[model samples]
Target: MSIQCPSCNSQRIITRDIARKLGGTTGAIAGGASGMAGAAGGARVGTLVGTIGGPLGMTLGGLAGAIIGGLVGSAAGGAAGAKLGEEIDNKVLDNFQCANCGHCFRQQD
Candidate 1:
């Protein structure tokens, strides 16, 4: 069930690390932005929730909100980043040339 190079039928295929790096970097950026947005929304909600507890309650609520928001955001970001990385590997990185034959081809899934 191993991937064979189409041109030379060689199994010495190597994955390109750069594709994962690029995909992960892009994913991190996207995740960070979404996380920030989540934090802002959470803070607003927390503020309202804390209203019942007074100023002290408000502070606690905001802190809790921020923590929860950050966790959720980070989880979502990581998942998205991993998916993007896989896509990059599949679509782009899989097209590496075989060292033995110097033939460029996509890896068989």
Candidate 2:
């Protein structure tokens, strides 16, 4: 769909997803912080399992577990955050700008 400026009728428009960007970043950080606990648990389990294969296996297993846990948390958080941000953009923020006239407006439903 083409978005035109309500004030100027200009078709040149830009999107400013301020909330989305901020939300995603904040959520990722929060999720990663929380993921630390998950990582610790994963590491413990990995270490226990790895012990059967000796020292190298234990080290690799722990590292892999921690990394996976952190990544999963970060990804989940980012997705959730982005969705929330999108809602804010649509309903609360003036998310569109007319490039030709520099007028900011909310998307019209």
Candidate 3:
């Protein structure tokens, strides 16, 4: 029941920590960028809403906008990150060789 090398049917499989690390880093960057973009857009909309309520209304509207923006951005970024992580895992990290057959192939999940 252990993981087997698809090509060589070998059990001597190695894990790649670097690939995971790189994937996480990539995800974080994307998330941060999206969050910032969302905040900017939210702020602009909030400002318009606040004009009707005056200073206090503006402050609340902006705060609300930022929160909403951040949440939406985070979700979108997280999804993008997961997709990227999978691609990295399949294309880069999954590259392994079977000691018995010497077959080079991607690891199956």
Candidate 4:
């Protein structure tokens, strides 16, 4: 269902899941905070929250949420990223590997 990295056979690829988790958690916290604030100010908090939850909602919150999300995601994804890298590395190892040099390479016609 997914394409493996040409250099690595890893299926554990970086995907929207990572982004979504990072983005979602951040969006929720920030949106919730701002939504609460806007609600207090007589604006439609629900609308703002909805918007915050849409299309990288963190974007709406600006750099603060983004930086926070990135840091959190990076930390959370470190092990996951390594796992993905390992899986890709294994895949690359399996798919490539020059018969002569013991080096991993893509097959070419």
Find the candidate with the highest lDDT and give its number: 2
lDDT of all the models against the reference?
0.74, 0.88, 0.72, 0.45
Expressed as tens digits, the lDDT of each residue in 18-108 for candidate 1 is 6666666666667767877887888879988998999998988888887778767776776777777777777776546677777766656
Range of the 10 consecutive residues with the lowest summed lDDT in candidate 4: 38-47
Which TM-score value belongs to model 1?
Answer: 0.66
Candidate 4 per-residue lDDT over residues 24-96, each given as its tens digit: 4555555555544444433333335546577455344444444444455445545454555445544443444
RMSD, each candidate, Å? 3.3, 1.0, 4.8, 13.8
Q: What is the lDDT of residue 72 in candidate 4?
A: 52
Tens-place lDDT per residue, model 3, 1-109, is 4657786667876644454556666666677678878888898799789879999998888888887888777666666776677677677765566666666667555
Clashes of each: 0, 0, 0, 4
**TM-scores, in order shown?**
0.66, 0.94, 0.60, 0.29
**lDDT minimum window of 10 residues, candidate 2:** 29-38
Using TM-score as the measure, name the better of candidate 3 and candidate 4: 3
Cα error, residue 51 of model 4, in Å, equals 29
Tens digit of lDDT per residue, candidate 2, span 67-86?
88888888888888888998
- Give every collision pair in model 1: none
Residue 24, candidate 1: how far off, in angstroms? Answer: 3.0
